[model samples]
Target chain A: MWERNPVIFLLLATAVIMVGTIVTMVLPFAYVNTERDAIASVVPYSALELAGRDVYIKEGCNNCHTQTVRPLVAEVIRYGDYSKSGEFVHDRPHLWGSRRTGPDLARIGGNYPDQWHYDHMREPAAMAPGTNMPPYDFLDNRDVDPELTRRKMEVLGFPYSDEEIQALAGKTDMDAMVAYLQKLGSDIPWREQQRVTLVGELVNPFAGDPAAIVEGRELYERNCAACHGSGLSGGFAADLTALNYPEEIFFRIIHDGIQPLRMPGFATLGNERLWKIVSYMDSEQVAP
Target chain B: MERPAYNYDIVKHFVHWSILWGAVSVLVGVVISFQLVMPQLNFGEYLSYGRLRPVHTNAGIFGFAVGGFFALFYYMVQRLCRVPIWSNGLARFQLWLFNIVIVLSAVTLLLGFSQSKEYHEMEWPIDILITVLWVAFTINILMTIFKRREAQMYISLWFMMAALIGVAVLFVVNGLSVPVTLFKSYSAFAGTNDANVQWWYGHNAVAMVLTVPPLAVFYYFLPKSTGVPIYSHRLGIVAFWSLIFMYLWTGAHHLLWTPIPDWVQTLAMAFSIMLIAPSWGSVINGYLSMNGQWHQMRDNYLVKFFILAITFYGLQTLQGPLQAVRSFSGFIHYTEWVPGHVHMGTMGWITLLICGAFYYLAPRLYGRELYSIPLANLHFWLVLMGQLIYSVSMWIAGVVQASMWHSLNDDGSLTYTFMESVLAMYPYWWIRGLGGVVYLLGIGVFVYNIAMTARGAQASPGAAAQA
Candidate 1:
């Protein structure tokens, strides 16, 4: 009867279940805490960013978008630096989600400007067409509740001053969300961004071709004209016609966008076409 | 002597309410599955996929699955022990508390109050409520088992005991939090530790809630419907003991290739492979139990449900360990493949077992024959087709998505943009959506059959006793 007794049976069962729990979970608790540190650049989320994180949690963006980049070749290329454990030290309930209906947001920090994230959140399709992400347009209308943000910071042990919390008073959740997105992987340097330079012996295959220059003008109009202006005049960016650098230097500059100026490199357009664009640039008379 | 009357009215309420929750689960599920395909369907804060996904899971697992388990356990315990349920008043109290907790969970979740733990998502207040409700249930079951008229406990009782204790330990340990506000709390652990603990709780929640409970119901009800004892009680004991021991270690399999400790991942991987043994032990036991009862499979609709349910359990268990391998986890961990794997457990195994248990209990509870076996067969076929299409489509989608994400152009650049991958999934998502609709239709048939059965039921003298 004792062998079949339900009380004894359950006691033994509970004990059996605990052995694994203790080994896998509890034993690790002995050392896992004191051995880790936050990334050198990781500070607690700023007031607005913390508030944005709350909105991210509230809206369940983690449901579709993961924040971790695994250490794989293509993954590192697609999303910047692979995720590190130290990078998430300040994360409370880590937004390292389990699904990816959307792309990983781990290193999305500097991938785009704040305006881009704002527009994307407002209407995802406008920025990246055919995306399945629902428009979070309502976030732009919703104010960040400072009381809850303060409370949340206190709970997560993120230090903040009253002034810092107050700065977020009238900001919209959309602003907060963008702040959060931009701050994501800023703690670590991302070497995998398209922000690379072409260094080596360079030969422009299209340097002397007048036909290439004509085609480059058309390509430039479609791709670069929006920011760099038509007719080699400046709009949001530098006046290209005033530049007097060698054609190879021009290729390097275009291959590596002026990072501080926010010009994007057209690396995906490949070497042949960018050289053509350079040919058009060299053919143009200086706008003196 | 005639058997003493058990508190069957409580069983009736639990079964009926769980079915209601199950319907909500299916309805929300269909909506969210389509939301993956159609972004326009996500209505702002409340009805969107994020908030409602938890609502769907909470309702389905805790609301529907757990509720059905309660109903079946209550029914089976009384008969297996050869005694009446202990404390009818406590059982009644538990029934109300269960429904209240579920309602609070659904409301609070829709309002965006969550712990953000996958299965254990309800806020602190609701968590406390759930704890109290579970305790009330556990004590009552324990007390009943303590005073059994039968000297030797059945294999089903052992399973029920494990589930009761296992859930209590897992829930309270993982649910530990520090409350910041009324609706918010932080996980007691942080960063990597938090990830480790969450998946430990997350995956084991499946083991304790989904696996063990259904096995209890299955072990008891399989023989009851088929009119044969399980092939080997000793085999059941070995399988039961090994399964409970191994399941807790395997939770870290979900954390493979992640930031959790290397040894922990390796341990989890090893134990996960070993788990296929005990899981199959139960599967083989079920198959062998049907030795001479093969003829019943043809004539008895209930037998078909049990056999199919066990078959899916076998398939799910096999697929789970295979996915846990580091190489395989690399491919499918975050893809639609994981969900496809999970639905096989939920939709194929657990739901089928719950439906079978409900069907078996309905005639006995309501004191009438089932409305129609043909409709039951129709319901079965629809759900089967629906689940196959849903899982298979997602599996293909996961493979395609994995390949696209891994593909490289000649320049060593990614071949497809992430948008291109999402766009490619559109057709499969449509098919998955249709599968959900068909599954929901099958459940609609089930609800109709049960409702009609109860409508014409001339309240049995045994069932008429007031709680």
Candidate 2:
């Protein structure tokens, strides 16, 4: 019975399987376990962003959207700079998905305003025609559970204060999702930030002029309001009312929009109408 | 020697339940395939593609494939060893545990309680249930092997041992995590490390679960079906050892061209290329075993499945290694090509072989001849057409998608935006979804054949024949 023991066969098989396991898995883990490379710019999610990420995970967005940008020449051009390994250090269960049914979201942060994400999620087909993403309008009706968010942050080992955790209370999944989307890749200065060609005379030519404001409203409604929202808040574009910027920055952006993000330039309107729209935007409330 | 009264009832029930699960998995697959094209098909929260995609995978892998593994392993172990199952009680317990875990897995996944690791998505509580079930299975099978009357173990036994040991190790090591709530947990590793560990588990889940068990079933049933012993048991042993050795290293291939360390990717790619040899080793063994039995392909419907399944196994291994190559991976890593590759293995190689196994076992267990060979033939044609259509269309889609993504204008700006790349997939998605419908129809025929055999057949293979 002892001759050519099956235990020996079992042992041999176990040994063979372990050799690869140790080499591929165990060694790298031991050596690189200490020196992690979370890039200098990367940081942990705040309370509401973490809550949004939880909603993202719960909805299984990773099934369709990948978070990592590959280091390919074309890919870099398509979705901004390639994703860095260090940027994902705070990711516990890493959402670097294997498929790309949708676009990569590694650099989605600061790419659009809060309102764009909200409208896009609520009605994806209306926002982008010829796409098949199911609408997520139900998120507006549901609020984040603060206790659960607190427990999740603790579980993920993220640092959060009570105040930060409390900020999630009464916030809808839409709000949290928007916050997370806007926070995503904010660490990096992507194309949208770098492309603004600031020239002199930043002030709007029609600043505080009532007649220009009225004319600007018509141009803004015709050209920008569909994307920028009728309230000058936002839709498919950034929330213009949130930030304060001079007219030259606005002039350049309006005349030469960020094409890669699919934002079109309205240089067709000419300088006068463009500045009138800028004046109209400048006169509007910057903060809700 | 008197027969040990090999238990057929356990094998019978396991086969029956597995076929049901397999049907559920296929039905869900068809629905989700359409959901990708016509997003309107995605109904409510629980029925959407995101929630049900995991349901499709889990039901297929665990509910269908793993259930099939249990059934086939029990059947093969007893006959190959010339001994009855070591503990009928353990086997009975395992049958229930196996099913409950699958049900709980489907429900939990549909509820969106996922840890989000591909292939290993079940959270901590369900994970513990799987561990208990695995432990019970391991103990029973090992005990059966230990007490076998036969001295020289068959090659299927070798493959079986490798699967048993390999899955236990892979599942446990990868499942290491710190649980926050009963329903949730965080991987012990993070970011790059988490990715490295996941594919190590993820890809090897293919090796141990998908490849090995089906190979074990194939080796057992092929010779049984063809009425000829395998050409070389020695080749099977060598292949089994080498195949087990190499497969574990190739998991990192999934991480190729990504953020993980470069050397790991190279090592994974090399091992992946080398893996074709051992995978083909069994394929060659199966082909050469048919040396005198070439006429069986005409007379025997079973031979059609075995030959084609092994042929697919050959093709799948070849495709897998080519995909692992750096340039090829860069082009099609996240494209539809990967899904196409995976389904060829699952639908073509694994499911075909196991369906053949079930057909072979159903008659013997039910004590009756198969209800209809024509329906079996119908299933064979339908599934083959379905798999071919699915894989071929997706392969075309992957190439087209990759080209469009890589396409650049002469001035060097992107020629197509991400949305444009998505728009190009519509035609192929429709074709792929149609293919899924064909595959599901084939599985429906399969389930009907097996179910009718249970109800229609009265003649039984006695306890003493093979026993």
Candidate 3:
């Protein structure tokens, strides 16, 4: 049966592939609620966020940055809570990349404000030192095509109203990209509440101590220079030298860490070390 | 009775184009390697690493590897069946369509129309083109096989058939997507399901396109080059069946620690380890076939490539299963180590074997001798050195990076920031770029030798007689 007729061989080959597809591809869909309305976290992307997704796909960001955080402890600590299947139910052809030349961006939304991503994308080296990433300044110049984006989304059954689509007009690619990034993992429960609670009454412990300033400089170099740049100007991450944050908010940010932004909480460094690092950053800001 | 004149013309066409595409793929790969260390090499919008990286992968897998397979498959099927391709016109049409599809893929990817699925990046329209093209090629090969003069199929025929059917199934299933625009589309599968399906297609694409086809070439050409048949046909059949059975179950191993069910991951891990047996089965067959004629390793340049190629295949199979283990994957899943493992298979095993096949075919196809055996030897050593440098440096860099990322202070604070790990990789990236340059230089020598051979250069008297 196997040797004589080629038909039987082809049938066997087809049968194996069918079995594989049924188990790996079809079976998973049955378990997960893929419809946007069925899952709370799986909201349809806003018009601006949708446009940014197009930019993300166009730029092939997923090549270096993955969107799925595995269930491993290190991965969870490094990239927020592990990714839930329902959170990505609306994502078409999910952005779970195979490699991580850069860090995972699963929970990148709201990690940094708009300006941080802007400065980082324009000149990665300006924010983080020793980065291999290239600048995407072209995004600033390119305008987003809301109509095309909307039409594309409509075809894919994304719930976008005409008014919402129209509001996306005149936005640059960078604007849309930032909007999209700021929306990632935004629906995770307690993310906003945690940030609010941490910042409510916190204050920098070593706001202007001279000795702590010196110590803070050392801490920044050892702990922050790789992503934030040695000059605190920027490379792979945001420019700490440029941003002006109130003492209380800064302390809260440092202690709690911005989970979505891939910044680990250094609370284990203790209040003293954390204060010193904050003081050091403040000293750099004040210096000529 | 005169056998129908086998279509060597179509074979010639595919061979020429395949060599051209292979060179393009290698050149782009070297550029991207350099871009990792020196970001200034990125030419702004169109050529950034983000955009061009996909081009490099698509060109390497679809253009170079698949193109070479078409050329060789056409050459082998005709001779094995003792008949011309079932449809001469259909073969001619496929030749042009193949070039058009590849060129379009490169252009569209650079213009930023990708689905973002690795290995299946081309958007909906191109996916449709690919489906049509694959079906045509499948029909041409299978129809020819069915009308063969030979009743019993050889092992190469088995592999060729598997590739024809295997690729068709994998491509069409994974290519399922909802078209959002002429240029854009979304995967029909959502989230975890999409990840699972993509890797299943991705890993098996490597198996069918890179693994089985090359093994088919090795089985056919190794014996022909050395004037010896493979050691055991029965052993070859066992290995083939076991490999096909085990390979599909192993794709989930790529998702080891992910949210995919633990049982699935463990199943993948077990199957991946079992796979080494069948993989080494072919490797052992290649080694034993060389029992009496081991001296060919020194005398014949082709033997050097085949033996080395199979050796790398053996090492790659072993390392792949080891990486699938849960603990090992925890250390290396997203590091430079994965690429290091991958390049050995592409550069060492597949590329070397294909180059050997081309070298064996060039003289007969062009009716002339290779321009220089010394040059071929130089090419061999250069690529071997280059591949070792590339894989070794990355492996070391990966281990260091993984250790640093997992390091913790006595107080349970992280010892190093992410930036420190990125900083440490600079020197290794520079070494990798250097390795790429050496490999590119080797490709230059290879292209030159083939070009010279095709231009009707004089063959040495002894070499001319062999052809």
Candidate 4:
């Protein structure tokens, strides 16, 4: 019965699948916790904000934006604190999207004002000028009633007060969309004191010294002149010494390496050496 | 008594048209690759990357891969079944419509009439056309199987059956939408339901289109290439059934670390891991079939393509399941590694096998020796080198990017900006473009050889059957 029959193979495959469900799928759910410290900070949305979240989902906004930042070192440094798993405990459908058509929105709240989000939504190019994002002008002054928006959110299982919906009646769809955008990445303290301390720990004694310039110039001539040019004009493929960039950008090149760009971040470059390189690049400018 | 000779004429016609569409697909792909490096290749307006991407993907998948399968299936089925196609008139109509649909897809996608769904991007009207065309093709094939002279259906038939049924289900379900205008439609499934359906369609498209159809072609062509039967038909049956059972559960793997239920994500990851077993079953079967015929790899061009293609299939299956694990997927899910994985399957396994199948069929269909065996051999090497370079460079880039993006300072802030990570991809992108150029050159050689062969060739034993 087991040797040649097709039915037996189907049965065997089904059994294996059921077993797989038990081992891999159902088993993991028993012990997984959704609670964490950040959950204390993540508050429930207002009635209007909930309506906007529904709009976000309807438009497939989650397809382009992510709400979670993995606890990787680079992510922590650039995007503020790492996102905790517990931060998403209250979320019914998580928004950790697979693609990055736009930037992550985990902590977008207060990063830009509500007006910025409103203008950005209406036409990203008008707001940012260089963005590739499509316009969501359909949200502006749409015929959708505030009551209808509230009902939709209610139907989607968002707990909202009827009085709250009645009070905010006739609000535009853009208002809700902006409200949702305003809630992104809102938890961290405004200032990052710890980051400054870490950067300070890695500093060199001669970081602001005049003599470091001569030493860095000599090093640049020996190691960097072939690619960057003698005049530091960035003569070849990627001209780092190009006039358009700020000196801080050069400081970054000395600190972190660019890999796929073929310009490696100088992780080994001393803080003093980096400052020197910055000095050489800054000297080319007439201070005008 | 009039004994009708076997019909190779329809087979010949399918071969020619399929190759034409294949040429369009690869040429567009090459042009788009250059556009990435030199943005001047962006013809502006409708010819932008957002629109042209669907053109390259849809053409290669439906036009080249599936179209080639149609020709191969039609030719192989009749011989195996010991009967002619259930309806030859229907097949001829299908061939013409097939070409028309491909042309329409190219035109409309370039013109920017898309649903913005990956692989299912064609507008609602074109989606309906595809459904009808597929149904007609499926009916013809299935009915032929129903009346087969041979009692035991071969392993190839199993894969063909999966593809026909699987595609119909995936396409119709994912394609359910309300058309707001002639060129636009909103999905019937909103929010989470829409996401579930899209990935369901997306990952299963891989199963039906990429996995099963190729399995059908591979099962039929591998034995034919080596002049030997497979290692075990029973093993093939086990692998096929297991693949069907496991693949549908796996679409959610792409939705990992998302808002989807943790249980659902875990289910997909587990199923994805289990998928390795069935995939490797066919790979092992291919290797075992070549047990005594290992020497053929040295002398036979067809065997070289077949063996290497299977080897790549094995590697891809192993790599894919590993990537599905939560830890590994976390690292590489949105990274450059993902593209490397996809291209290895497409360029290395699928395209390599398709090219081999055509080479094996060309002489048999035209009744002539190859226009040039040496050129075919050269084409093989170029594609192999190109696919390897493309995949490896992307893999390295993905690892670096993933690690950098994950890096954090002691104070728990991000170390690299998004711009910095993006800047890192330029060199790898250049290398990838160079690799694409090499692959494109090989495809050019393939097209030239086919055109020359068709221009002047004596008909073979089965040549009378085609007309």
Candidate 5:
């Protein structure tokens, strides 16, 4: 029967493929509940963030950095918690890259300040030495098409207001990309608690030392200036002078990085250096 | 009986273009391999690693492998079916259209207009062109097969048919998307579903394009070169059916440790392990066919390629399933080991087989003896040594990476930062780059040999006609 009839053979062969595909690929979709209640915290990208996502796709970032954190202890520790199916419910054409030429970016949201991303994109070697990532400085000058981004969101059936689209009009592709990156894996309940935790009462050891303050100022210029503005005014990160938190809280936050936020631990920089950075911050601000 | 006047024009055209594209892909691959170690090599916006990596893959898979398939399929179908191509005009059109689609793919990807899906990077318009191109070729082949004078369909014909249907279904299904702009589209499937579907298409693209098509070519050309029929036709038929059944289920093996459901991962792993039986069925068939012809391995250059290719296929199939296991995947999932595994199949098995096929076809098409057997032997050794050096260095690097990543201090703090791991890979990366240079040199030798062969044919018309 298989020997003579080509049509029968073709039909049977095709049927086998369809059955395999249907069972694996197609059937899984039917089981996934698209309703909001099926998963918690699966929100669509905001108008600005949606635009940033467009920039992300346009730049082909997924070719290097993967966006899916696997369910392994090593991955969970290296990245944050293992990714949940619910976390990516809003992701269309998920960027779970098969190759990892660089680290996974699944939980990169709020992991660094916007300025750090900007600097890193412009010149990655400045931040992480020996990185093979190419500079995307061209994105800095290219303005995003807000209207087109909004239209695309509408086509995808995401709810966005006209006001939101108008707000994104002046934004650059770099701004959108940064915005999109800052939104990734940022909605977990535990991450919110980590951000809200305030360090308890403790004294700064280096507060009165003039020499330490001078060193601290230099360290802040090299490291903190990218996220905090050059003058310590607000930019991608929070304004340092505006926050009147105790010196100890500042020390703890700097020592043990803030989870789900862009604040990586400066523990590698040594406790003495961190104290100096805190001292620099304390001296720069006038008492409220 | 006079053999029906077979059309050699399309075959010759595809061979010429496929070799050109093959060289381009290998050169680009070498560049990207170096870019991993030397960030300075990333020239500017357009030539960045992110943009050029897809170009390397698309050109290698579509331009080189698929392009070679077109030449081989057209050549084999005519002889097997005992008829001329169903339409000379359609074949001619497809030849040009194939080149156009590939060029547009490279340009659009470099411009950063991509779907960002691996292996399916081209945006909506290019997707349409590819679909159209596949349909045209499919109709031509199927129609020719239906009108054949041959009484029975050969195993190679079955593989050709499977590839036609398999690729079409996989391509279209994975390509279902909502067009957001002229060069942008969003996949219809969201999140986990999207991942499952993409890899389903992704891994099978390897299966259909790289695995099945090459198997078809191997089954056809191996016997023709060795002057022996395949040891068991029944085994070939069984292997074909089993491969078609098992390959589709194994795509999620790529998604093993990810957020995909555990059952799906297990299913994929099981099927992947099961895949080895059929993969070896063909391997065994090839080996048995060469039982008494082992001496030819020393004499015939084509035999060296065929034997080594099947041997790599055997090793690839075994290693592939082993990697799919959850415990093993956890260790090497994102490491350099995976690339090492992949290159053995691609560089060792598929490329060698395709090159061997070209050597066989060149003389027949051009009506001339090869320019140099010594050059072909040199080409084989260079590529073999190059591929080994490439895969081996990567394997050692991957092990070091995986162990370092999983290491912890007594207090459970992570032992190595990600950058430390990156730093460690520099030596391996340099070695891998050197391996690429050697392989590229091999390709250079190959092209020069083929060009000289064709030129030699053109130089003397009487000698060519007599042969």
Candidate 6:
């Protein structure tokens, strides 16, 4: 026998670990189940949609398109809603693919016309200037007969009949993928939310005009002094004077939107509203 | 001097065969790198990047590195303990079975049967075979340790024991599965729990099997080749225990910024940062052991490789923990920086140490002089330069790609599309291909040197073999 000393230790430790493993909850301690939300308009994939899904898998399209939406400011601004567990209920293998070689396709549904997606896939650079994605010209009519697509569907376990194929819309290579794409982000209700608010309501400008030194100090003291410091010392993001960005850069960012980052472009605010915020920012000078 | 009888036959056999597989690994690695640069190099399905990747990894880790370690361990253990192996028959069986396992792993992976886990890509059946093989080998080594005639256990023995037990626990736990079919299986643990365990096993697989075992060889061989005892055995023990304690908790560092619990990820990140202490402990120990004996680095080809290997290990460990932090992980986790980190361990640390150990063992084990030390030194420089070029270029490529992807225009949209970032990596990929060719050339030289050495000349009676 190999000396019993460590064997005893192993046995005791194994028992403790085995018991801990069994009793320690195999599921993550922080899980919050979110699969039960309801969707009024969503429906399960029709037979034709199922065929399109098969095409998606066979083409290795999952390598490029991601389905999952990360919970970040940029993701929400760029891709619409953050992914919820309920969005994946109908998916059998859950195509929340990891790599973003192309773009997120969770909400690509109806985002573009069928021909655009078709021509894009066939020769990606034809549509986008700097694309490295290999052209899927193999899916063109010359390479793939309509009959072969039917045969390929059989291997993928879709029980589609010729009659169903005859009834499909937009008869081309793009039609199949677009059918899958059109369903991407159609589930979220916030897609049509239309609201616009004034900039002055959100940002305070106590100082009358930014060019007027006395007025600028008054605005700076009231609105920006506490966080930026009385002299506009470094706050969380950066000291205001430290920013060497051009006036146009600040104007565009303050009014427009930056996706995936917390920095929202200020495009929603008017030109005069952004100038007021800039004026107050220029007036504060930190001692350092 | 009362010379202890060493089992040279098995050592000779393992060293010879390992050099063969080492060539295969480097050759495959070179071809794969070429395929990335020129897609025309890819022959359809069987030879694509998808299939060749596992072959490169398995050949490097299991076929070459592990085989070299096996040969060295067998040789070192017998002499260190002042006794014969507890079971030569078991070890011989292990050597044969080990080759079978590597061959099977290579063939099956090429045939497109994979579990799809990064390093542990072998399917369920092969995983079981590996587990059984490891268990048998572990039993034999532990039994030999049990029967040792030496009074006090050396620090190398402590590392050997940790590797045996650590790998057993890690391999078994991470490999737990519910098989759906012959080659397919779902992890028994699901979701973030699964990711946690997988990385836990994944990163520590580097530690226990790749990291500690090679350090054991370095610590033993460095002093032994120079005929000097270690500078401080007690320091080596401290490094060993600290490494064991910290390594397990650092696995979830890979899952930073993901859905895994904030606390778990933070804990792993913290432990990974703390890991630098133990890692450098061994590095410092290796260098300090070389005090006033730096002259050997010039005359002794084996010491050159050994010293350089430890230096690389020190750099690799420092880089690894820094990358594990959340801020840095955000930039590099899924990028070319990731592969750069891995190859440093594989090409720089593990390969260099194995080369030194093999060169030292070949002459004594085979009772012949090394055919050429100049050729061995030549091999060392080529591989060293090649690996450095490969890793550095990839690291720069990954950082540039990541920063581009994360960059935003003032208008709040991404400055570069995903395609533009990928386009930037092609030149780096081509450079990496060139670097791999250089490394493969080095392996070719090494294999030739070993083959000629085995058949070359006899040593004088009772004389130590020359490098």
Clash counts per candidate, in order, are 0, 2, 8, 30, 5, 17
Better of 4 and 6 by lDDT: 4
The local distance difference test score of model 2 is: 0.84
Q: Estimate each model's TM-score.
A: 0.91, 0.89, 0.91, 0.72, 0.91, 0.73
Clashing pairs in 5: A52-A176, A110-A261, A110-A262, A111-A262, A112-A262
Q: B1-467, model 6: which lDDT tens digit per residue?
A: 67656677877777877878888888888887776566556564457555786788788888888788788888878877788888888888988889899999988877666655557767788889898889878887777777777856677776777777778887887787756456545455543455556677778788888987998899898997877778887788678767877777777677676555566778778888899998999999988888899999998888889889998899999999998888877666556777777888899999989988888877776666788988998999999989988999988988897787567656455455455676788899888888888888888888889877765644343334442
DockQ-based class of model 2: acceptable
Candidate 1 lDDT over residue span B1-467, tens digit each = 88788888999999999999999999999999989888899998788899999999999999999999999999989998888899899999999999999998898888888777778888888889889999999998989988888888888888888889889988998888889888888788877777888888888889989999999999998999998899998899799999999999988887787677789999999999999999999999999999988999889999888899999999999999999898888877788887888898899999999999899988778877888889999989888888998999989989999998888767565566676788999999999999999999999999998998787576544443431
Off by over 4 Å in 5: A33-37, A192-251, A259-261, A266-288
- State which docking tier applies to candidate 4: incorrect
**DockQ, candidate 3, vs. native dimer:** 0.50
After superposition, candidate 3 runs with Cα above 4 Å error: A34-39, A191-215, A218-253, A257-288, B1-4, B457-467
Better of 4 and 6 by TM-score: 6
lDDT of 3 by residue, A132-246 (tens): 8899999999998878888878876778788887887789999998999888887787544432133245566676579888888887786677567786888666788756676
- Model 3, C-alpha of B263: deviation from truth (Å): 2.6
Task: Compare candidates 4 and 5 on DockQ and give the better one.
Answer: 5
lDDT of each prediction vs. the true structure?
0.84, 0.84, 0.83, 0.70, 0.87, 0.68
Comparing candidate 1 with candidate 6, which one achieves the higher DockQ?
1
Per-model C-alpha RMSD: 3.8, 6.2, 4.2, 9.0, 4.1, 12.0
* Predicted complex 6: DockQ: 0.06
Candidate 3: residue A15 lDDT (0-100): 74
Relative to the unseen true structure, what is the C-alpha lDDT of residue B195 in candidate 4, on a scale of 0 to 100? Answer: 53
lDDT by residue (tens digit), candidate 4, A119-191? 6677665544334455676677553356665654544455677787785677777887788776665644541
Give the CA lDDT, 0 to 100, for residue B325 in model 1: 90
- Model 2 residue pairs with clashes: B367-B459, B367-B460
Q: Model 5 Cα displacement at B173 (Å)?
A: 0.3
